[model samples]
Target: MGAFDMLSIAGSSMGMHQTWLDSLANNIANVNTVVSTSQTAFQTQTPIVRALAGGGVEVAGLALSDPNGRLVSDPGNPMADADGYVRAPEDDLATQMTSLVMAQRGFQASVQVTKDAQDTYRSALEIGRR
Candidate 1:
């Protein structure tokens, strides 16, 4: 691939990683949400990440978690259902933390790639002028 293509790919990778981070943030924010039934549970969301063989990257879609929300029985809870059962999201905090770390790494790598490309171009210009 050309240098421009490398830059574009790296740029797109950074964007994708940003989207992933956003998704993870949203999931973490709603970790305590309560739903009445399986159909209405607050599902953890994950980004559909795909790699481009040639250049760049694209987000295909977002996937919803389905491991089943925890059925907590609390009659006094505001979101409690008629049977006193609340569907709390089944989010694993440790898993989410790991994902956040991975996303951060991906973003950092993309940024470094773009920066290197810029430095290479600048060096070439200096050589041409000399």
Candidate 2:
């Protein structure tokens, strides 16, 4: 692949991972958000990454978790219903944390790849100066 192609691939990977990280952050942030039993709780979103026909990856779309969140008993909470129940997100903190780490690593790796590609390109230019 050409220097530009390598950089573009790395850039695409970084973008996809960044989007994934963003969604994971949102999910973690709203993990404890509660709503009235009659309302839908915050739904977690997952980024769907797809490979391009020529090269690189992209975030094709977002897949959302179930809207019908689990019911929790928080009698004292104002958002609780008459039956002392409220809707809480079904997101699992452990899963979200693990995904966060994976996405971070992926982003870092892509950055490294981009840097390496640039360094190689620079080295080629220096050699041509001889």
Candidate 3:
């Protein structure tokens, strides 16, 4: 509606994208995690974003991906099961990388919006002072 409102919206978007990027990074970091058969494998985390009433976004919660991971046969590994199989996180590196790129772009767009809004406000103030 207003310049300030636009800035608020951009700020909220930036925050939401930051959360998304953080979750993506976490998922990527644990992509190669190996766990014992008895232990649960690292589950990918996704940020749950929701639109606010006025005009903004918020991270409502975190959604965990399926806990079922891939089984890797490693006879020499200590954490392997009786069948010499270890559970590895089912994280897809390609998907995580793609999501990371999207989030980065979203964050950059929001930053640009905020910067533009600020510049417009500054120019208005300068014009008013003239």
Best by lDDT: 2
Candidate 1 accuracy as lDDT:
0.85
State the RMSD for candidate 3: 1.4
Best by TM-score: 2
Clash totals, every prediction = 0, 0, 0
Better of 2 and 3 by lDDT: 2
Per-residue lDDT over 59-121 for candidate 1, one digit per residue giving the tens place of the 0 to 100 score: 989998875777889788866778888887777677888999999999999999999999998
TM for candidate 2 is 0.92
Residue 59 displacement in candidate 1 (angstroms) = 0.5
Better of 1 and 3 by TM-score: 3
Each model's TM-score? 0.85, 0.92, 0.91
List the candidate numbers ranked by lDDT, top first. Answer: 2, 3, 1
lDDT digits (tens) for residues 17-122 of candidate 3: 9999999999999888888888888999999989999899999999997787878898899999889999887767998999999999999999999999999999
lDDT of 3 at 116: 94
Q: Cα deviation of 63 in candidate 2 (Å)?
A: 0.7
Better of 1 and 3 by lDDT: 3
Q: What residue runs in model 1 are displaced by over 4 Å at the alpha carbon?
A: 73-75, 81-84
